[model samples]
Each structure stands twice: as structure tokens, then as C-alpha cells.
Target: MDIDVFYGMCGENHKRLETIEHLFRDCEVSARIWAGLDLGIRVENAKSLNMTDWIIDWVRYLLSREGGVKRVIMFIAILWGLWIVRNKIKFEGLAMNSRVISGLLFESINEKVRTLSDQVDGENLKKCLKGGSGEHIEQKKSEIRDGHPLQMIGNQEQCNVIRVEVDAGWERTYAAAFRWVAYDGTGQECMRRQVRTRAESALQAEALGVRDVLLWAASGGFLHLDISSDCLQLINEIAGVDKEDHLIAGILEEMRGLSSYFHCLCFKFIPRHFNGVAHGLARQALKL
Candidate 1:
């Protein structure tokens, strides 16, 4: 069948060329879907412009992570889901909600994993969805493995430490915002701040947020601090677990330098939901 075809723009956003990279990773809808998955995988950090190379690179990276095989499977499933969503929009004029796509993917993966549980070493997959009853798994929100152990501080010395949560929101236009909320030892709110800035990538935005938060804590006379962030990669890089990412090396170095100002400061990783307050604040700052 021969048909007239002229448009080359993405079906989902109609903003960029309908290349494989844009369809699967760069599209607005695809971005939202990935963010909603709650996986620490950052599509914005993709280093390759070629689709095949991009997939291979991400698969290799995921295989080295904690839930190796399971992560790979989900990565593949997300690509497949994105394609399905693109086709639905392109052929049927139907715009699927990002949450609906996420829910469907989770349900499909759960059922398939269950059906094949006895056929393979599906233990990791099963564990990932343990509390799930054919619904989206809450565990995925915090699945990024902790990079390193927190620096030990005597319990006596931690009595007056303030805890803070920091997060960043980034856009494709390079506009970014950083936010941090601090709480006293008694869990009372002490400081909350948001700053607008620009970043080259999401990782850079996260690193900038951590650095700003550390500076705020030190300058505000909060000598001892327990800093938390939902960006596991940033936390790991700061702890020297994953230092290969050269993109944010400068910010990380500044963060390390700032650490000396605090008598005791530790960076911790928390789930996205746990960092909701700072996350929302950062998103709000992006509008300013």
C-alpha cells in the first residue's frame, strides 16, 4: 500500500524530528513516562546520538547496578512501551497519559514475571514487586541501591545536628532550580530556600543543589548536618562510589571543599517520595 507521507515531526510532541532517539528518550511524553517510573535512570544523560549505541550503553550500565538483570528487563520494557505509545498516538490520534502508560507497564511486567517465575532466576524481579498486587510497585521509587555507608559519627555528637533535604528540577532549555529544606534536631523546620539557575544537564542540576545546600548549612551556622537527596547517583558520586561521571566534577569538588566548614556532615540517599517537599519547591522555583 502506497500512502502519502510528509510530516517528520514526533507524533507525541510534534516538536522534534521523529528519530528513534527523540521517540524513545527526548519526547516530552517519553520524558514524563520515564520520570514517573521512579527509576534513577536518567535519559537526559544519554551520551550517544545513535539509538542502538544508546541502548547498548544503558543496558551495559544497568547490568552493573544492583538488580542487574531486572534492571535490564525494565529498561527494555520501557523502550517497548514507548514505541507502543508512539504508535498509538501516530496511528490512532490517541494521546495516552503518562501515568496510565506507567501503570500498564508495571502490570504487564508483574504478570509476565509471575508466569515465568518457575522458568528462571526471577527472584530479583519477584522481590522487586513483592508488595504489589498487580498494581504499580512502590518499591521502584527507592530501588536505586545505596552507594556507600554513611560516615560514622558518635551518637553523642549527632544530638544537635540539623537534617536537610535538597532537590533540583531541570528543563530541556537548560533552565534549572535548586531547593533545600532544613529541619532542626527536634524535627522543626529551620530553613527553606529555592534558587533559580541554569544547568547543562539534570545531573549538574542535582550537584548544584547539593552544593548550595551545603553552603547554606555552613553559612547559617548549622555546623553539623545530615543532608539527604533523592538523586542516588549524585550521592554516590559525592561519596566516591561513582566518580567516573566527569560532567559534574567541578561541582562535586566544590561540594567536597565545602564539607570542611561543617564539623560533621553526611550525605544520604532517600526515596523520591521522601524528598517530595524539596522537589516541589524546586519545581516551583523553575517558574520564577
Candidate 2:
């Protein structure tokens, strides 16, 4: 049988031939999970390349990083999870969604992280797991100026800047919701907003949040701003270093256009622990 016919059409888009490229890159289910994992700029930049070249670039990139071993393990877990889900759907007629696959990948990675935390450098591995440490918690407290608990941690350069934290919750079968909260350098809540929208993937949902928040801030005349998200891939794409040639490309382009309106704007990636409030709001919005 032809490879395309054997693998079958992509579950996310039935019209496309289910080649490896389409399954891993173009399919909505895989695209969202990959985006959520945030492998780094190199992985994002390699998206347009063939699978062999992409894998080579990704492995080289991982091998050169400080906590590369942990990243490689997580990458393997994600791929394995994707494969398992794909096989289940193909062989057993199991219906899997992005949310389910993402959850499985995350859980598998977390379990691996926990098992390796003792053997590896705890601090670095914890950071790799996207979990903040006690030092981070204390730093977050010290950043608060007005005595109001913002539950946000900003970069050192973010002092006196409007730090906006954005997060999205996506369910393949249901609508996605995005929530953003703005905090002053001193960690005082300045503004908060939530919106419900339809998105085919979590990556698109995140890109939408970044685009909308940038437009909202620019319109409000917030010149000095720092946009942060738990989604590192989103930030990397916004910075123009990581190019994602997928469904979220248009949203990223809009963000690039809106970014020029600010006097001084920076995109940063925060660990999920530092972005608890905004993430919580996003999860809450999903239920509405």
C-alpha cells in the first residue's frame, strides 16, 4: 500500500494525505501539543524543513543546551504520546482530542521529571519542568511594591513596566478561552480581561491571546510593556527568531504588526508557577 494510504488522512484535516510531515507539523492535534511543549527557537525554526533535517537540527540544538538531557526526555515523551494516540485512533477507532493528548504528554513528562529529579540537578530540572523554586517564590514576593498580591514574577528589567501575563485553555471539542492580567512592576494588578473564542488548536488560542493583548495594550496607550506567557514558543515567534508555519502564523503576523506601536515592548517566558493567576483565570474561563 502507498504510505499515504496506509497512514490514512489526517484526523484533524481529513482532506490532507497523512504523511509524516502532515501528521507532525500540519495536523491540529500535533501542532498544539508541540507548541505547548515549547522545545525552543531551533525547533520552531526547523518547522519548514523536512523531517530528517528537522530532527537533526533539533537534536543538535538540544545537545548544545545546558539542560538538554531533560529536554530530550520530554521530547521523547511527547513523540511517544503522539504515536500512542495516533495508533489508538488508527487501529481501534478510538477518538482522541488535542486536550487528551496534551494531558497525556504532560503527565508522562511530569512523571519522568519526578523520577529523574533526584538523580539530576534538582533546580535545573525543576526549571525544565516549568516549576518554580522557593527562590522564585521569594523573588516574586519581593517584586510586589503596593502590598497587593499580584502572584506574578517579572524579569529584573521589567521594573516599572506593565507586565501582562496571558494564558489560554483549549479543548478540542469545545471553545477555547484566553485570559490576561496586567501587573505593574511592583506586582499590583492593573487590569484583567478574558475572552472566549473558537480555535482549532491550543497554539492558535495562545497566539490569539498574544495578538489581542498587544492590540489592547497599544490602544490603551501603554507604551512601556512586557508581555509574558508560559508558552515559550509563542514568545519566541513574537520575537521574530522562531517562525511557526502553521495555523497560528497569521496571528503571529498580526502580533508583529501591533508590536511596532509600543515605545518599549519585550516578550518574556515565565514558568507556569510565576503565571498562576492568569493561568487560573484561563482555566476558569474555559468553564464559562
Candidate 3:
């Protein structure tokens, strides 16, 4: 079936591909899959018998088949996520390993379980979140920054805020921000940008920030992200309760193009009082 993104590829027959063409793309997915495949190989020490050659041959075979099995795996996982289906594989429970990411991705977790659902209490298990039924997570409003404490998601602080200061300089416009860890989760990068003044408005600035991050991460490969800003007005606008002015339409247009690569991304707001560090960075960028 052709997706909208297929037709949208600007005459680039992105949707329809013969076996050879499709396999070429799956080779890219294999690049990602190989990271996980390595562990499976290492566990068995499949290094004997010119293993690399055999692996390459196997991949060529899968490609010849147009990656039919891999696509089915991805489709099934997406379905599990949509239906919230819980099941098991190899005697492993389904809660910890959802169809989306688990079972396929490698992790720091040790002592593989027969039941699979067995996990460290503090980490992701059945239902993705490591808690009883994930009800606690849903009730808390501290997931992002506000006047109260912010809960850290991943490496992010619960309510960390980003302050982007724009400079309307005589020569050129630029921006920057103060960098700090509101939640600062592991395997994550945290920083801020304070741009100089733009022809666009502040709401446009917020949209640009979102767009820029999405574009960068999809191209650069980020698994998780939590971006918070003190621009409540702009943040709300990006969340779509308010309409954007004409100034930012073009920038937003660019951002919508970046969607497939990210796994989790959330934008948040912190009160201005808590945004002193970002505010300082913006002020500093203007002076430069």
C-alpha cells in the first residue's frame, strides 16, 4: 500500500520498488539491525567457518526475498503497539518486549530471562515503563517542567527549561541558550540554542527549534529526546491550540518533512523564573 509520504517524495518513486530496490533500502535497516545481530552472533561465537562471509551471503538472500520477513516483523510490532497486545515469544513475556523495539534492539540489561518479563524494578519491563501497570506515570503532571518539580524522562529533568535569546544585530541575526540538565537521562545529549533575532516571531522561533531538532535527529539518529522551553506562548502555539502567524509557515513547512527516524520526542514548558540559565545564554548570544 502506498502511504502519503510515498506520493509526497516529489516524483521520487519512494513508494513503489521492485525486489532489488526494496532490498537496497533493507540493507540500510540491516545496518541498524546488525548492531543487535552482533550480540546474537557473539553469544554463540558464530565466528567460526568464515562467519562474516556467511552473514553477507545470508543478507544477500534476504534482499533477494526483498526483506519480506523483516517488514512483517516491523508491521507486527507496530500493530502490537497500536492494539496494546501483550504476548510472549521464546517463553519471554510480551510486556517488556513490545512489538516496536524490544526483542530486536540491544540493551545494557544483563542476565537474559527465560520468562523475559523478569527485569530490574527501576527500568523498563512489561508495558515499557518500569512500574505497576504504568498507572503512576499517567497520573503525574510532573513529567515536564512547570512551577512545580519536573519528573525526569530518560536523561531529562522533570521540568528543565530552555531559554532561547535572539539578537537583532546590525550585521546579522543569531540565537543561543543556557545549557543545563533538567532531567539529563543516560545515553542522551542535552544542550540549548539561543538564536539571534529572526524575521519570524517567537512562536516561529519555537517551531524552528522543534523543526531543527527533528531534522537533525532523524538524519543523525537519536532514540529519545525531551526539549523544554520557557516560551509558554510559543510552546502552546506549537502544541496547536493557537494558530501560527504567516511569518513561520515556511519554516514549519520544512519541519514536517522530518518524521520517521525518531522514537520519542516531547516538547515542554517551564516557568520564566526557572528559565534563568537559558535566559542568560540568550542574553550572552545577543552581546556577541
List the global CA lDDT of all models: 0.66, 0.64, 0.38
For model 3, where is the 10-residue window of minimal lDDT? 1-10
Candidate 2, residue 103: CA error in Å?
58
Off by over 4 Å in 2: 1-159
TM-score of each: 0.47, 0.45, 0.36
| CA lDDT for candidate 1 | 0.66
lDDT of 1 by residue, 68-174 (tens): 77676777667766655555556766435556556655665555555444454545434332321322221112213454434422232636988889999999999
What TM-score does candidate 2 reach? 0.45
lDDT comparison, 1 vs 2, better candidate:
1
Who wins the lDDT comparison?
1
Compute the lDDT for candidate 3.
0.38
